[model samples]
Target: MRTVYSEDHRLHDGKHELLEGQFMKVHESPSRADIVIGRVRSAGLGEIIAPQEFGLEPILKVHDEGLVRFLENAWDDWAATGRTFDALPHVWPVPGLSRGALGRRLSDCIDGKLGYYAIDAGTPIMSGTWAAVRASANVALTAQKLVATGEKSAFALCRPPGHHAGSDFYGGYCFLNNAGIAAQAFRDQGARRIAILDVDYHHGNGTQQMFYERGDVLTISLHADPEQEFPYFIGYADEIGAGAGEGYHMNLPLPWGTDWQGYSAALDRAMKRIEQYGAEALIVSLGLDTFEHDPISRFKLAEADYQRLGQRIAWADLPTLFVMEGGYAVEALGVNTVNVLMGFEQR
Candidate 1:
């Protein structure tokens, strides 16, 4: 598998983020990508190449124009406000507000725009965020282009993981929905159907919302139950897609302490649905946060379990693209991550 990455990802490092009403150190860091890249080289997976620029068009395909514009100008706007700290949204319209009232209130308010377009306060936007967000999207697109040309599979080592960002909202350490954008690109390239298997520890609420009403892309997420995880508003099994997308969206919300036996079974069910749907390509939202040693997530998946995880995905026998997402076990990140790719290669 070819690996797509860029050093520019180091630019968007935020100083801190809010967690549980207190400022906490950001778990998503540049060193996570560095360690994973080192493992890719140590394991001899494939060549690592800088991402080719795809411009803003591909990203605009999946994200809102207003949201994109805000991201590009956010740093300058915050600077103009004379705030030296990283900008974060503090206020949000509650559930009962009228749509027009909320829109009017958010339009004239920079702070409101921040909350309107953001789902959580964990992602802080500093001066250098625009460049890195664009670069990360390009990295995912580069891998998509390679996989589309029959490369068997490719790995997009995206930093500040994107499964949590949707078409119009950003949060959970994500700015742009990398996997969602890639899945849409695959469909635009003539693939009749695509399956996005999001195995992150936290639910990929953004990815699900992006395709909730579409049938061309099948999204299956296996994560901690929303009642107990971040992005707790959605990710229920009953949300089985809306119009033409009925039965296309699947959510397997497991409990916090799930082991490989339980996790693998959920994965098997996800793969079976993909087989039945006859998807032309497979996009795996590969988040290693499910690792037992991860500091920010729950689940008991050991390093060896990742190897099995890859082996099982190989059984599906489709063109696969693994887009990196969340994982916070810094020391074991490389070995645990590379093990998945190695298992797939050997399989």
Candidate 2:
């Protein structure tokens, strides 16, 4: 497995995030990536490579144009209002909000645009966010290119992790759906079927929404049940794909406090479904936040559990691209993450 990484990830680190009841320290931090990188090196997983500069073409393929434009200009627009704090959204257009009756929803207000385009208030837009986010997408795209050329497996160590952003919205500290974009690129480059296995602690609401109506791409996510998790709107097992996409989507909603025994059982079922689907390539939305030590999550997986996780993934026997997602246990992040990659390698 070749690991793609970049130090620029540290640039987008936020000062604080709202958690529990008050603004505690941000669980999503730069140190999380550092720990993962350290574990990759300490385990001698594989050679680490820098991502290629794949410009905007690949990104525009999956994200909405107006959304991209908003992300690129969000920081500058916020700054122009003479507000120097990190920008977070507070209001949103839910049910009776009267859509399609607008010509610029915000009153030239960055705050309103922030809420309009975002789903939660946790993800903040900082000065270096645009640059870091674009770079993170490049890392995932570069890894996909490697897999397309026949690499058995590749790891995209993306930061400010993606999987929560949809075509026109961004949240869950995700600005771009890296795994979603890669799966689409795989489709564009001759792959007949692509399956995304999102093993993150949180449901890949954005990725599911992105491909929910398409049959060409199959998405399976095993996460903390939406009933007890953030982004608590989607990710139910009942959300089997719509229309032509029926039977192509799967959601294994595990309860909080699920240990490896419980986690692996759901994983086995997810893998079996993928095998039955006969996908040509695999994209793993690898998130270690399920670790018992993870600050914000509730699963009880340990470091060694990742080794088992990796071995099980290898059983699927498909060319895989591991795209980094959530994991907030800063100290154990690397050990848990690299264990999965190394476990796959050893298998």
TM-score (all chains, Cα) for each model: 0.97, 0.97
Reference-based TM-score, model 2? 0.97
> What would you estimate as the lDDT of candidate 2?
0.91
The digit string of per-residue lDDT tens for model 1 on 112-212 reads 78888888889999988999999999999999999999899999999868999999889999999999999989988999899999999999999999999
Stretch of 10 with least lDDT, candidate 2: 98-107
Candidate lDDT values, in order = 0.91, 0.91
lDDT of 1 at 22: 86
lDDT of 2 by residue, 239-276 (tens): 99999899999999999999999999999999999999
